[model samples]
Target: MSRLTRTGQNVLTEAMMRIAVLGGTGLMGKLVVTAARDAGHDVVIAARSTGVDISTGMGMDAAFDGVDAVVDVSDHVTNNAKKAVAFFESAAENIAKAERKAGVKHHVLLSIVNCDDPRLKAFGYYQGKAAQERAVEASGIPFTILRSTQWFEFGEKTVSVMGFGPVALVPRMLSRPVAAKTVARSLLNCVEQGPSGRAADLAGPEDLEIPAMTRTILQRRGQRKLLIPISVPGAGKAMRSGALLPGPGSMSAGPTLEEWLSAR
Candidate 1:
């Protein structure tokens, strides 16, 4: 029996799906789970901590038993091309096979914006994401791919990853940093709306400079560090060249970086 629910102006009439969220304990995954459960759907947490490993297919058959949809927010944080490719490909394949067997209807994927740009291929992580998108496309299950821009949380992490001694090596890149909460809401909307193939790109309210964002982070943390802005040669260049920015007519959401930072 199908169920009906309201999301913004749209009323979703899809069945009350038993949605299995891969990496359901992670940052974004947690939000997705909460949203699904709040909407009166059965939410299954699939993660390494939950004993459902998507990469190896262990315990997946049982997990997918009555699941109507699978939202894959699982992620492997790596910059190595080979490792990133291996993880996403393996996980996608395993999930697709399990979903096929379980007769799941929708497979929702969370990916980065501009991941398919040739200019960004120099970065191993982007390469892995591209491969992950490919793997999902080839999967027989009907799917929806939500490509989003960088998150506000990523700003702080960039400072840590690029910091050197007394200085932070900030890239001369532009980004529209969306709130993870906004992203979570969007993903849940997709889940309720069912599969839409390639949906419109999601982004933040304003275009921001990477170095300025890092500086804001330093100020917020009360750290006095020299932010050395540099143009990266390959992948960095692509990022700075606006390859990571969302295209025209993309869906933009709050809170803006300034507003988000001020509240934090």
Candidate 2:
């Protein structure tokens, strides 16, 4: 059954609780904050911009004050492997430290799917995420870990990351390309459920081929763009194998791609 169909005053009364989003300013964070607030939860937006840097522990003592649970969607923008490791490991340790001090109960997160699959992981991005999950699991606080598919916005961002002599090329990578809002809503449900210690992974209602989604966006933008899909060597292969797709009974019944686009 669809979660939305089951939602009502009863669900809201249960789901409406204090929840903090670590990277509330980011794309996924934005949707989570809005969705949680719409569901009647007391929401706190924590980020460097909001005076909370989890990695350095600056402003954390004050930021987590009275926070019921923490949803960490924070990310560092870096292709450098060492930096990724530092950010995630440090941030995980700090979150555990501050939460221990504050006595916060649950620490939820939106982690990438197949994070443990070595072949699909990029340098330290997956490794860092794995480290973070391990830290939280070892912390003994009730936690809910959600592995999610790639975001639709990621495709948009990937397209802009190229400057190959007036031509843009997509990494011959594969993705499920679920909407950010869908991911947000699913994570919120887990938050309201308290802590499940790694809940079921979530994906979109439809399986969208990355190349097709990219082409659709390009067409919508009125750019007669040439998108070259390159079969990347390592992690790319894992992604193509559907490592990020959700498992059975893991997805919420939500609007399909056409329905979502129409509503937007």
Candidate 3:
């Protein structure tokens, strides 16, 4: 049996592995790199900025050389379903090929919870995510997919993109938002545990309205805005009624939205 010890909120394992982090420059990606390094694991960052592009499969062979496992945190932010599907599918296919080439043992993907609900089929982003999941499953590689709820920072990102001076059209949806750092720690924990396919969903402690959360975020930034709740036909309608919420047996933890903001 392997020995384990607690370090703050993270569990450090005695068996360290050489890990390759795809999209290692993004918010979650950077956190994973830090956590892995802090836990004494060697990390290789595979990203376009580092000359490893997953889109066209360039520069991946060298990046995965001797990598014991691969963690994919690649993301494309878009509401256009076709575009989102294309991006994720391409990324998945390329990453799968590279993993096979490098003979990597384990593959981990960070995805969204409830992304495959029939109600969300019309939502382009979720549709894209579903496609990516299917690709990963068919890749013939040992893999684990950890689906998580939206992060607390999502409120800030929504406000930034949807805000128009004193008015913001926030999505009419519900979410259990966890901290991005917390999610990062969970991903690395999954990495150490090895491949287990479709790990338990990860969520935050509180159930919240998207618009209300965004409003609070705006207030924290000293911006008072007229928040209007807008609904879409399919996925948007589902989200308002908790379609995005985790099902039974999800792992819900927190530093809630307020607590996370205070810490920042």
Scored by lDDT, the top model is 3
Which regions in candidate 3 have their CA more than 4 angstroms from the true location? 1-13
Once fitted onto the true fold, the runs of candidate 2 whose alpha carbons sit more than 4 angstroms away are 1-15, 163-166
Per-residue alpha-carbon lDDT of candidate 1 for residues 49-79, written as tens digits (9 for 90 to 100)? 9899887999899888999889999899888
Position 92, candidate 3: lDDT: 89
Q: Local error of candidate 1 at 82, Å?
A: 2.4
Error of 2 at 263 (Å): 2.3
Comparison by TM-score, 1 against 3, better one = 3
Worst 10 residues of 3 by lDDT: 1-10
Model 1 stretches astray by more than 4 angstroms? 1-15, 160-169, 221-226, 230-233
Write candidate 3's Cα lDDT for 101-211 as tens digits. 999999999999988889888888898898899989989999999999988888778777888987778788898988999999999998999999999999999999988
Q: What is the C-alpha lDDT of each candidate?
A: 0.88, 0.77, 0.89
Candidate 1 vs candidate 2, lDDT winner: 1
The TM-score measured for candidate 2 stands at 0.87
Residue 175 lDDT, candidate 1, scale 0-100: 93
Residue-wise C-alpha lDDT for candidate 2, range 1-264, written one tens digit per residue = 113324455542243467779999998899999998887678889999999998799988787888889999998766556777778878888898998898898999888876777675674577777777787789878899988877766656767786365466776545555778888888888887889987877776667777677777767657666777765555677666776666676765456656655676
